[model samples]
Target: MTQSTTRTSSVPPLPPPKERRRLREAKAMTEKQVAEALGVTQTTVRSWETGRTSPQGRRREAYARLLETYAAELDEKKHAKRKRRSKNPENAATARPAPETEAASTAAPTPSRKKPLNRRPVRTVQADSRSRQNAQRRKEKAAALAGAAAAEAAKLTPAQAFDELYAYASPALVRQTYLLTGRRTLAQESVERAFHLAWHRWPEVAVDRDPAGWVRGAAYDYATSPWHRFRRAHRHPDPPNGERAGRALRKALLDLPPVYRRTLLLYDGLGLDLPETAAETEATTPAAANRLLHAREAVAERLPDLSDAHVLHERLRELTETVSAPAVASAPAVRVSSERRAKFWTRAAIAVTVLIIGATAFTVVTAPRQYEPTPAPGQRVGGVPAPMGPQKLSRQDLKLRAKLRDVPMNGPERLVPRIP
Candidate 1:
């Protein structure tokens, strides 16, 4: 066998993690701008700066090259400042050049000066302090501009924004729903339905101050709906498992009324403030606080270990996070489904309207136009009796007739007689 030599590409070295941020800021570049240049997400760039992750392969090379360019520009700016400083006669006379070590660190940036015109040491110190303050203000202004630019660059269309929101919120929402409903399938359906509704009502949802909260409310409502009990699929409760505390906690949550459970989850599990929880639950703050109290009492009754609010929050969050979430359909699919459902309901409504119109038209064609009243029911009365068959004589009438036949006819009875 013959040995063969091969050449490989080497990735360039990156600056220290802390220095990465300094370099980018010093260069007056936004994370968005750097991300676009490197063909990555701004989050990835942030991760690189934060030392959570490092770039690799061509990306590593690209990042290193970009940082190097920023370094070069900073060096150029430093040189330009030196040239300006040297050209000023007053500063050049007294001020010596900055040592290499003093010029190296960029953590604190100070204005370059050749000399002080006053030559008063105390005034020079005061002036330098003012310059440092000015430099800090400049840094803050630059950072603000960078943030605004990033936000502008990240502007997304409605569909794109919805998709992003769905991606960010759905998985966690499913888990939350699971904790609420205790059923994997129900949780999955609830989350998907909520998103579908959100997409259908995108105009309302997109402009909402808390779009996630809006969707969350819808999901929680659906997950805890009493109507779900009528469905064969959701008639039964999901079996609880895991540690004693977790199962007991889930059972306690399920046992509580939907409103109380929701309040507790919002306040404890999700960490919403009382006012926010109340707003999301559509209840007054006091009502929400009361519900939270009752819910906590119920849970504490079962498991004394969770009597403390912090302990309950920890257990609830852990249980929700540990449960596996069902995979949700893509945002596009959800929007399409919502459109289909809306169209179906609309067509059904039109059909019903047409049927009603037809019924009215039939009534108009066949209904009697003349004035007619309902006939009074036949009734026997003293003035005008209904014609009925002759009734049989009673025993008393027969006896009276027999007595009349046996005795001589007496004076005509002073009574009214029937006319023939």
Candidate 2:
């Protein structure tokens, strides 16, 4: 009898815990199933997958082999599914209709209708060119019209521009100020003052992207300014049915930070959108949105019953509208006399002319002075001759120089006292 030798093969290394978990997922095996297949606790499989602990010895080898077998099975199933799908692609694309009964089939078959063709009319080259030229002419005409309109607008005086803007913006600004200040008189005053400033600086204000926003900001500042603190002592009459909610809303709004209060008023009180509110508040859109959110939260906390934004906005509108805004006149009142205006212009011209003269004088006085260039070596400068070389001194001159060296340089020269 001859003895046969048995050769053992080495097991491959196991992948990392994450890779093991991914492989298990690929195989569609849950942790419990994988644990049961390897004859281990589900917790142990979880620990292995989570990298807290791992399988060892025979368990590790078994797990790896099980995962390999499952992966191969999954691949085989996928390949079979693909092959089946390819074999009957139409069946895969759409569900097959149930087989018709013999009686139904014996009935008349429905006629099939063909889909209509979508054919675009072809254009000739000449027609295409003509159409292109017509479109170009229309575009040029539109551009010219736009330019002419802009030129006409530019020709309007600053006062005219202010009149146009003020007519539409004054009422809204007055209402917004009323919401901010909670005083009808102060609100009216604030709107008037802001518009007055805008009127005075119409040349500058009209060029701004949002002149209405500028006026709104100015009015808000005026309404909240400390100079108008005297108005707080005076009580204003509230409209009918607005006493309680108006007081509560005013107290809540006043308690908020200025930015938050302004944001809330612009967004909810005035029905301005977020971007428009941001422009009015001199803040970025996101920052304005955040301020509005914070304001709403704060107000909601104060008045729990009125937590909804729409409800709060409606309530605020009612409160603001209760106090009627001052009527906007067709034309702004001219407060300054014609003589005062003339005097103001005259003074401004004098100041400007004085500044120009002063600047000219300063330029002349501080400017570099012109002078003749220094003469070259061996040439005469002014009336003095330029020294050509070192000069030989006489005995008297040398004695004079030695005497000068012994004299004090800074103060008066004194003769040295000789020793007796």
Candidate 3:
């Protein structure tokens, strides 16, 4: 018979006993299972089992528990090996005592000393300083922002405060105005005028629950003013029949029978919800308001498309830019001529008084002289006789009278002043 040959596969290296035990325990799996899972030979698994090398890092955890289990099995196998050796008396006797040399007798070679640990104190300090600097910069920036915000808030006046509130409501106002007027110019003018009205009554307006509602009301009234419509109707005067279209637009407005244009402007523009709109428009309710709104819509639809917002914005921005700041507070007041006024009235009064006095004095002077008439000589002597030389008619006067008898009465009439 041929001699049979048996060959054992070589095992891979592993770390010391403690590491092997930890590796097996950490894996929480058996050695055979771990070897099969890793696609390794059983000899390789046993190598890890015998403590010649260790799995590094993350891989160590995967196999720690598994290898530990394998290590326990190895321990049992080692015990069996010792037992067998002890029981085989002939084989044990062959384990003869060794002759001890000094070098051999010396304690088993001590393990190499481990390197000292390196502490990174400078790196730790640098990281701490960087963190503190970042925190300080953030604090300073936050403080500056807070200060700016506070200053801005402090600078706002009551009028500006109200303007901001109105601005918040401007989008709604724009929509409302566009729908109602069908002309951007009209809408913008109406809004500005309305704001002016609101400013005039701001003391009362600001206290209201909704100041925007008041503004809308004012805008409606402004837009629908007969004067406004008339001006728009006659806006163009130079071109041939230029004023006709304007007249027609005005006629349409004036022809609108019952509903006030104000109610229509608010209902159509601003999108004031029914009840609120009614309150602003002074309508009875949503139903009544709708009637006015519908009426305005019918008329507005016939007009040109004048609701381009971009155009409106440009126009408005231009208007704002063109408008000069009022110098009311800074400008000198108009110097009315008080002295001129006073002098005029004074002269008039004096003239009237003098005329009245002259009329009265004339009447007084002329009244007394009228009562006494000169008495004639032959008349009853209620008055003194005329002067003697004039009492009797002279001979020459008689001769003249005889000659006058023949003459015509009108040719030479005698002057008779003697009778009163």
Candidate 4:
């Protein structure tokens, strides 16, 4: 179906200003009274009531207040009508009606007279009503309490569940991956793949006393995997040789052996103490972990700008400290593409046109010299063999030869024709 450009008016378009005035008048309030309540001039109120203009912003607030007062007055009028019908003027004027008159009023009780007897039933009714209300209140309270308990149960602490583990493990993970593959891409990929594996089994994994251990194991396997290891070897074919801190550090980190690099990162980069590193790495003690760290330090000595162990440590510290937490990954949403595909095709056509125009401009700016075919050697004006190639020369070549009839050649075959 085609969409509408112009909006359709509703069946009763809108009430006219005259009709609104009638409605206001029916409520027994003058425009002046409403204007006084709204803090507006009587003329403004008259304009709105007559639909000459509509109230807006704070004026609407005043209009709404006036309407509410009108409604209350109508309710009062209704109550007064009902009271007049229910009460006899004589009974209304007296403090208490005589017993006979009261009985006479009730013989065929009208709605007004019936209200007393109906009201007399309220004592028992009030007790029942209060009991029902109290029961409802208790039920609501119980439900709210249960809801609170359920909410508390569902809450999981990310700081405890992931942050602690991340802080404890990230450095080691980064370092180990870097060392094994000797490439930044491999190390990063391995770490991500390892976490992906852990996330897949979070329920069972979280219950384990040593979740980080599970993650490290997963990471180690990923780094050592045949496919991953191959990729790591070729990850950074051209490591930049520069003084930029991040680039140098990236290059250095990518050059480590898997084990020592992992150990160093876990121990230093991630701020994991030796014991934690040992647990994650499945090493026996802090001494073994320290030995691996020393090995990494020794390797750092060989790199050009990384002269001192302290320098490498400081660089690593700075990089690691400045690192922001990794963002949470989300499942890709399923997309509906018909509309998007149309938009894409439209944009692509426009882009192609722009590109073609730009290419035309570029060609004109860097136009190559026009090729003029050389006249065939010793060939005459009208019958000369084309000098250039297998293809026949253009008429311009003939013109040049005719214009330069006095030109000389060293030999018939001396000037080898140029090959484009």
Candidates in order have lDDT scores of 0.79, 0.70, 0.51, 0.58
- Candidate 2, TM-score vs. the true structure? 0.43
Best model number under TM-score: 1
**Candidate order by decreasing TM-score:** 1, 2, 4, 3
Report lDDT (Cα) of residue 405, candidate 4: 61
After aligning candidate 1 to the native by TM-score, how far in Å is the CA of 212 from where it should be?
0.8
Per-model root-mean-square deviation over C-alphas = 20.1, 28.4, 43.7, 30.5
Candidate 2 local lDDT, 1-420, one digit each (tens): 123222114445566544566677666667789888889888788767644455777887787787677667878998899667544643422233235633343474433112122221133335557877998999999999979977987998866777778777888778777667666777777787777767766665665546787777778878877666555453443343345547778888878877898888878877888756654564545788899999999999999977998898998777666645556444446324323555788899999999999999999999879977898679545977777998999999999899888776654335455568
Off by over 4 Å in 4: 1-153, 156-188, 209-213, 224-227, 231-243, 303-312, 321-420
- lDDT, residue 325, candidate 4: 27
* TM-score-best of 2 and 4: 2
lDDT of 1: 0.79
| lDDT of candidate 4 over 1-420, digit per residue (tens) | 123322222112233344445457566666677778778888786656433356776566556555656557778998898666544443443435568867766675556554543242444457657977998999999999978965764485632455445556666566555544555565566666666555545554555545766676677667656564245456443344342546555556656655566676666555666645554554434454666666566656656566565666676666665543223222111011223445677799999999999999999989877888888689446866767757676899878766556556556533555468
Decide which is better by lDDT, 1 or 4.
1
Model 3 lDDT tens row, 199-286: 5555655545466766776666665555754675534222222333334333343345424444443334333445444444433354
Best by lDDT: 1
Candidate 4 overall lDDT versus native: 0.58
**Model 2, residue 151: C-alpha shift (Å):** 6.8
